[model samples]
Target: MAVQDRGERSRRSILEAAASVFDERGYDAASTTEILARSGLTRGALYHHFPSKEAIAAALVAAQSEALMVPEHPVRLQAMVDLTLEYARRLRSDPVLRASVRLTVEQSSFNRPGMTPYRQSADAILGLLREAERQGEMLPGVDLEELTQFIVGAFTGVQLMSQVYCGRQDLMARVSTMWRLLLPSIATPGVLMRLRTTPPPSVAGAEGDGVREGDAETDGTARPPVTPRAPWG
Candidate 1:
């Protein structure tokens, strides 16, 4: 058990270090030696976990899927908004996530394969939108799949622009603007009023809230139930 635990720790160290290097220097420019130095792990240990630099990059790309903590809300649309807002907050603080975003965006330039992270994110959003539609939270005639694609694309652009312009310091604000613009078109008026573009004060302070990867539940805060109002006469 000790040996296995040590191995796991070693692997994580390598990945974190590699992520930092990749975050600072693009994939093509980041060197294994720099990762080794950052991790303080021997060449043999790194090779034991990741055989090549591309493998490290692939692992980082895959890690992006775990970055968002999607809480369950009675209203699927509210949950979607929470997911985006929380993700934007995280983008400002999580190094691994930032690196994952960078690698995913630059994958074509780096000649790496597998966009599983992007597909997984799209599928998750699509599922939420589909549920929102079923519950009549979405606008009539809304295309769930197309809306999913649009949200994902818009988020990617927003985060990238935030990173480029303000070093992501204003990501949460930018995300709020995005949600304000998108909700009117995607959600029913009642749902739109109930959804919050900004994170609640508690949630904002808990930006560093340490939820484990793959955990679907929120950190015990009660979310408001979705209440759809009657359309205006």
Candidate 2:
């Protein structure tokens, strides 16, 4: 048990260090030596956990899939909004997520085969959009499939721009602006009115508290706050 626990810790440490290095230097430019130095682990230890730099990069890419929490909401449209807002919040603060974004965007440079993260993200959102359509939250004539792809593409662009321009500190705000523009086209008036562009205080506070995804839902207090942000100017 002790050995297993220590091994898990070592593996996590390597991944985190690799993430930070990848986030700062990108995949091609990031070096194993730098990752080793940042991880504070010996070469043999790193090799034991990750045989090669490509292996570590692949691990980081896979890790991205689990970094965002999709909260449960009575309204699936609002749940989608919360998922995006919460993801933006996490991207601003989580090194692993930052690294994942870097990996996903720059995978071609590294000769990686596919953008698995983007596909997975699109699928998750597509599921939500399908549910929203079933619940009549969607505006008339909305095509959930096209809308899902559009959203994934738009979010990728928004997050990339935010990262380049502002270090992602303004990501949540940017995502809120995105939601405001997109909601009118995708959601019914009633659902649109009920959705909050900015994350509610509970969600925002929960992010800081390091609560796991769905914790807010389990507590049954995931409702949007009284004063959601007005649309960006």
The TM-score between candidate 1 and the true structure equals 0.86
RMSD of each: 5.1, 4.6
Candidate 2 segments exceeding 4 Å error: 107-109, 207-233
Instruction: Tell me the whole-model lDDT of each prediction, alpha carbons only.
Output: 0.78, 0.79
lDDT by residue (tens digit), candidate 1, 9-71 = 999999989989999998988999999999999999999999999899888877777866667
What number of clashing residue pairs does each candidate have, in the order they appear?
A: 0, 0
Per-residue lDDT of candidate 2, residues 170-223 (tens digit): 777788788878887777777777777777666555545564443322232454
Clashing pairs in 2: none
Query: By summed lDDT, which 10 consecutive residues of candidate 1 come out lowest?
Result: 212-221
Q: Pick the candidate with the highest TM-score.
A: 2
lDDT of 1 at 22: 93
Reference-based TM-score, model 2: 0.88
